[model samples]
Target: METPPQRNANMAQIFHRSTNFISRFSLFAGIFLAGLALTGVLGLARSPYFTRQNVTRSQPVQFSHKHHVGDDGIDCRYCHTSVETSATAGIPQTKTCMSCHSVLFNNVGYLEPIRESYRTDASIEWVKVHRLADYVYFNHSIHVSKGVGCSTCHGRVDQMPLMFQANTLLMQWCLDCHRNTEMALRPLDKVYDMAWRPAANQAEIGRQYKAERNIRNTSELSSCSTCHR
Candidate 1:
């Protein structure tokens, strides 16, 4: 049988080479797939849908911040009266709305809810858009008093027709400001000015304010207990 056509020595080498190639290829493919999965997860986490940024919820009354704050030039503290004095910025009560609407848009259909709530002396359960975990003990009064403008955290509420969560409000988000608070700081008098802009020498001014206020360093601001109580 022609000595069974003796198998070539190269056959073993070829088989080994093929197996090694497959092993390396598989390792690379696994790594690529794992990388893709990780990237996708991170992208989803930061997306608007996940962060609830600009997502408007249905409110009992479609109170437009754009109209009230932007058009009418109403100060933020006008409605959020407790922002500077309390840990939580208290929502405007029914009477608070009627204080203006009852005279301004009293006949408007949208103001009906306000009138009803006022007539009944019932509280309007306004849906909270920005909410942090209970474990996070945030003090609004402290932040407001520290020269941090409302727009720093709430974004341009004057432009938002329906209030939405402007910032991610994540721990990292809070730390970003706490670590470099100078960027967000404004004059105490301008805290309620939603359209407030920094001066040309804002950095220098911010440093001055930081020194004057004796603000804590990044190490303390980023500490676990800073937000987590």
Candidate 2:
């Protein structure tokens, strides 16, 4: 007589072949969604909203760079006094404004804050436009000495009605210039020129200046300590 059916043979299947496909699809979909989410977060971090590039901010006094620098031919150093010799670009004191406003537009209603600041011996709480993280250390004098122009990072301030950040000022943006610095170097005399443009032979000129100025190599400039410290 035939033996009774084995227990294993009689056992029913718990999962179907389609279950394999469903499991695989679920795993891949989760991975894809996770990757997409990560990419979106990174994009948002670098966006204009986060970086504040090209966004004009209101100041305590509405100082117009366009009128001052473009129309009046005022130099940047008149306001940012320590840019050439100090790590920080010193903000223009109330006296600096009084030097001119005391003669020109002295009685203007908008400039009442300036007169008040001078009289009270209190500093104008001017809002800073181009701000960097506290962890990062930037030296204005070092970059100025390296033949980098004011407009290179600050953009065309002479044309700006209100001062705003012209670039992302991100670490990668800095690295791009550091890796190929020859392209950004300008004549030292033209450092403050807002209308300065790259000449047809700018590449050649830049290479020459880079060599003469003894700028550090890409590896050095891109190092962590270069900007962090």
Tell me the alpha-carbon RMSD of every candidate. Answer: 3.9, 2.8
Top lDDT: which candidate number? 2
Model 2, stretches more than 4 Å misplaced?
1-21
For all candidates in order, the CA lDDT equals 0.86, 0.92
Q: Model 1: residues >4 Å from true position, as ranges?
A: 1-20
Instruction: Kindly provide the TM-score of model 2 when superposed on the true structure, using C-alpha atoms.
Output: 0.90
State model 2's lDDT.
0.92
Q: Which residue pairs collide, candidate 2?
A: none
lDDT of 2 at 13: 87
lDDT of 2 by residue, 1-229 (tens): 9988778886778999899999999999999999999999999999999999999999989999999999999889989999999998788889999999999999989999999999999888988889999999999999998899999999999999989999999999999999989889998998989999988988899899999999988899999999888
Model 1 lDDT tens row, 42-84 = 9898888888988999999888999989998988888889998
lDDT of 2 at 94: 91
Which ten residues in a row are the worst by lDDT in model 2?
A: 4-13
* Cα misplacement distance, residue 16 of candidate 1 (Å): 10
